[model samples]
Target chain A: MYEAALTLYGEAGWAGFSLDAVARRARVGKAGLYSRWGSKERLIVDALAAWIPPRPSGGGPGPLREELIRLATAIFDSYFDPVGLVYLRAQLEAMIYPDLFGQALERLQRERIRLGRAIVLRAVERGELPEGTSPALVLDSVSGILSNHVLSTPASQRRALLGRRDEYVEQTVDFVLSAVGYRAQGRDGLLSL
Target chain B: MYEAALTLYGEAGWAGFSLDAVARRARVGKAGLYSRWGSKERLIVDALAAWIPPRPSGGGPGPLREELIRLATAIFDSYFDPVGLVYLRAQLEAMIYPDLFGQALERLQRERIRLGRAIVLRAVERGELPEGTSPALVLDSVSGILSNHVLSTPASQRRALLGRRDEYVEQTVDFVLSAVGYRAQGRDGLLSL
Candidate 1:
C-alpha cells in the first residue's frame, strides 16, 4: 500500500493524489485505507516513513572521504529512482505547509542529519578537518551537488549521467573535501594525496 | 494574468493550476485566458518565461568572485521568494513529464547555464582558474549549494538564515573557489586572498 501510494504520488502531482486512486492502485478496498489512515496527511506521513531509505545501523566511524563518498553516492543514486519525485514533492510542501510538513520532515531527517554530522565530527576528531569546521555546510554541499546535477540534467542525458555516477560522486566528495581542506589520514580514497 | 498564473501555480502546485483559477485570481475574464492560451502547457510556458529572472545584459565580465557572489546572491534570494515553489514544482514535473516539461525547461535553462559557463570560461581565460576546469561542475556547485541550503533550512530557523544571508553567500562562494583552486586577480572580492 505504501509503495502504491508513492508510485501514484510520484506520477501525479498533489492534484492526482486521492484515497480512491491510491486504493485502486494498491488493489485494496476503500474501507481498509480509511481504517488505516483517517486523513491524507496521516497516510502521507506513514507512506513517506515507510518509503524513506533505512538509516544506517550502528557502526564505528569510518574514514571521512569514504563515508562522504558513500553518502554522496546514495544521495545521487536515490534522485534517479522513483523516490526522487516524492523527495521533491515533500520539499515543496514543506515550503507552503510548514507547520505540518515541516514537523514531519524534520522528524524524518533528524537521524539522517545526525549521521552526516557525526561523520564530519569524527573527521575533526581525527584531525582530518580543521577545528570549527561547519558540518552542516560540508554535508549540504555534497547533497546539493548531487541533487542539483540530477535535477538539472536534460531527460535525454539521464542515461549518460547514470553511466558516470561513480565519477560524479567522487568528484563531488573530492570537491567538498578540498574546500574544507581535508587531510589524508591512514585509509581513504584521498590517501594518495 | 501572468502574475496571477505564477502566484496560483506557486501556491497550489500543478494540481491547483487552471485557467479558471487564474482568471479569478487576476480578476479577468475566462474568455481572455482561454483565448490567450488554448492549453495549460502554453500558459505554463508563458507564465514561467515571464517569472524567470532576466539574463544579465551586456556587461563585460567582472572579477570572478564578485560575479559569482552576485549570481549566488540572486539564486539564493529567489528561493526565499514565492517563486521557489514554482521552481521546485517545475523541477519535479520535469522528472515525470519529461517529454513535455523537459523540452520546455531545457529551452529555459540553456541561456542561464550558458551565462554561468561564460563567467567561468572568462575567468579561465584570464588565468584565474585552471585550463581544464569544468564549467558545468563549477557552476553546478554554486547553484546546487544555494538550492540545497534553502531547501534544507527548517521553518523555525528561516530568520536566522536570513540574518546571515550575505555571510553565507560569501562562505559558499569562497568554499567553491577554494575547492577549484581559484587564483585571485585584480578588482575582485578575493583581493584580500
Candidate 2:
C-alpha cells in the first residue's frame, strides 16, 4: 500500500496526489488506508522513513577513505532509486505545502546528517580526519557533489555513468578528502596529509 | 504575458496550468494568446527563453579565478531568483511531459553549456587551466554545488547565507579550482598550482 502511494505521488505530484487515487492504485479500501495511516501527511512521512536505508553498522573494516567511498556509494544508490524520485516530488511539494512536506523533509535531512556525523566522528577518532573538521560541511560537500551529478545527468545517460560506479565513487571520495586537506601518499598508499 | 504564463505555471504546475489561466492572470483575451503563441507548448518555450538571462557579453577583465567567481555569482543569482523557482518547476514538469518540457530544457541547457564552455576555453588559452580540462565537467561541478546548496537550504535560513554571497562565491571558486588541480598561491593570492 505504501509503495502504491509513493508511485501515485510520483506520477501525480502534489496537486494531483489524493487519498482516493492512492486507494485506487493500491487496490485497498479507503477505510483500510485511513485506519492504518490516519492522514496523507502521516502516510507520506512513514513511507519516506521506510524507504530510507539505515546508516551502515560498524563503518565496516576499511581505511577512512575506503569507508567514505562505501558510504557515498550507498547514498548514490538510494538517491538514484525510484524512491528518490518520490523524494524529489516531495521536495517540490514542500514549496507549496511547507508545513506538511517540510516536516517530512526536515526529518529526512536530520537523519542523514546524524548518520554522516557518525561516520566523520569515527574517522576523526581513528586519526584519519583532522580533530576540528566540521562534520556538517563534509557531509554537505560529499552529498551535494553526488546529488548534483545525478540530478544534472539525464536519465538516459545515467546508466553509462553508473556502469563505472567504482571509478566515480573513488574519484569523488578522493576529491572530498583532498578538499578537506588530506594529501595522498605514494601510489596505492593511504592518505597522509 | 510571458511573465503571467510563468507565474501561473509555477503556481498551478503543468497539470493545472492552462492557456485560460494565463489569459485570466494577464487580463488578456484568449484569442490573443492563441494567435501569438499558436499552442501551449510554444508559449512555454517562449516564456522560458524570455526568463533565461543571456550569456555575459564578455568573460570580463580579470584573472581566470576572478572571472569564474563573477560567473558563478551571476549563475547563483539567477538560480535563486523567483524565475529560477519557475524554471525548477519546469524541470519537474519535464518528467511528466517530456516531449514538450524536454525540448525546452534541452535548449536552455545547451545555451548554458555553450556559455560555460566559452569561459573555460578562454581560461585555458590564458594558461590558467590545464590544456585538457573538460569545460562541461568544470561547469557542472560549480553549478551543481551552488544549485544543490540553495535547494537543500530551507527558505528561512537562506537569507543568512545570501548575506554572505561573496564569501560563498569565493569558496566555491576555490573548491572548483582545487578539484581541478589548481592550487592557490597563498592567502589573498593568485592560484599557482
Candidate 3:
C-alpha cells in the first residue's frame, strides 16, 4: 500500500497525489486507506521515509577525510539511484508546501545532520579540523556539489559523469578537507600560499 | 498559454501536464494548442526556458569572492521564490525523463556554466584565483552548496534560513575561497594554517 502511494506521488507530485489514487493503484478498497491514513498528507508522510535514498552514514571511527569521502561518495552516488528522485520530489515539494512534507523530511534531515555532525566533532577531537568548523556547512558543501552537479549536467553527458564518479568524489573530499585547514595526508593538490 | 503550461507543470509535474489540461487552464481551444505545439513536450520546452527563476549571472568581472557571494546569494534566495519550483520540477523530472527535458534544460545549464566559467577565468587572469583552479569546481561548489542547503533545510525553520541568508552567503563564499587558497583581504573567519 505504501509502495503504491509513493509510486503515485513520484509520478505526479502533490497535484496528482491522493488517497483514492493510491487505493486504486494498490487494488485495495478505499475504506482500508481511509481508516489507516485519513488524509493523503498523512499517507504520504508515512510513505516517504522508507522510499527516500540513504544519506551519508555514521560509520565507526576513521580518518576524517576518509570518513567524509565515504559519506560524500554515498551522497554522490545516491543521486544516480532510482530512489533518489523520490527524495528529490519530496524535498522540492516540501519547500513549496511545508505543511505536507515538513515533519517527515525534518526527521530525515535532522538524523542525517546528527550523524554528519558527530563525524566532524570526532575529527575536531582528534585535531583534524579546526575548533569552530561547522558540520552543517561542511556536509552541505558535499551534498550541494554532488546534487547540483548531477542535476545541472546535460542528460546526454550523464554517462560520462558515472565514469568520473570516483575521481570526482576524491577531488571533492580533498578540496573540502584542504579548505577547512586539514593538513595534506600525502595528496598532491593541497593549495599552498 | 505558456504561463498556463508552466503553472500546470509546477503544480502537478509531468503526470498531470498535457496539452488538453493546458488548453483548459488557458481557456483556449484544444485545437489551437495542438496546432501550435502538437505535444506537451514541445509546449513545455517552449515555456520552461522563460519561467525558470534567474540563475547566477555573469556580471562584469570584479573580485572573485564578491562575485561568488553575489551569485551564491542569488541561488540561495531563488529557492524561496515561486518560480524556483518550476526550475526544481524541471530539474528533478529531467533526471527521470531525460529525453523529454534534455534539450531545453541543457541549453539553460550550458549557458549558465559558460557565464560562470568566464567569471572564474577573469579572476584568475587578474591574480585573484590561482591559474590552475577548475572554474567548474569553483562555481559548482557555490551553486551546489546553496542548492543543497536550501533543499535540506526544514520548512519550519525556513524563516530562520532567510534571516541568516546574508551571513550564510558570506560563510559559503569565504569557505569556497579559503578552500581554494584565496587569501582573505579582511575577512576574519578564513581557514588558516
Which candidate number would show the highest TM-score if scored against the true structure?
1
Pairwise DockQ winner, candidates 2 and 3:
3
For model 3 the local lDDT of residue A14 reads 75
CA lDDT of every candidate: 0.77, 0.69, 0.79
lDDT of 3 by residue, B125-147 (tens): 76667788888888888888888
Question: What lDDT does model 1 reach?
Answer: 0.77
Residue B32 error, candidate 1, Å? 3.7
Q: What is the interface RMSD of each candidate, in Å?
A: 1.8, 3.1, 1.5
Q: Report the lDDT of model 1 for residue B11.
A: 71
Report the lDDT tens digits of candidate 3 across residue range A38-58: 998788888876654565566
- Once fitted onto the true fold, the runs of candidate 2 whose alpha carbons sit more than 4 angstroms away are A30-62, A78-80, A92-97, A154-159, A183-193, B30-46, B49-61, B92-98, B154-156, B183-193
In candidate 1, which residue ranges exceed 4 Å CA deviation?
A49-51, A54-61, A187-192, B49-51, B54-60, B187-192
How many residue pairs clash in all the candidates, one count each? 0, 2, 1
Best by lDDT: 3
lDDT of 2 by residue, B54-115 (tens): 33346665576877888878767755544445665666556555667776676666677677
lDDT of 1 by residue, A20-100 (tens): 888998899999899889777788778876666633333356678778877777777666566556766766677777875
Candidate 1: Cα lDDT at B6: 82
Ranked candidates (TM-score, high to low): 1, 3, 2
Against the true structure, candidate 1 reaches a TM-score of 0.88
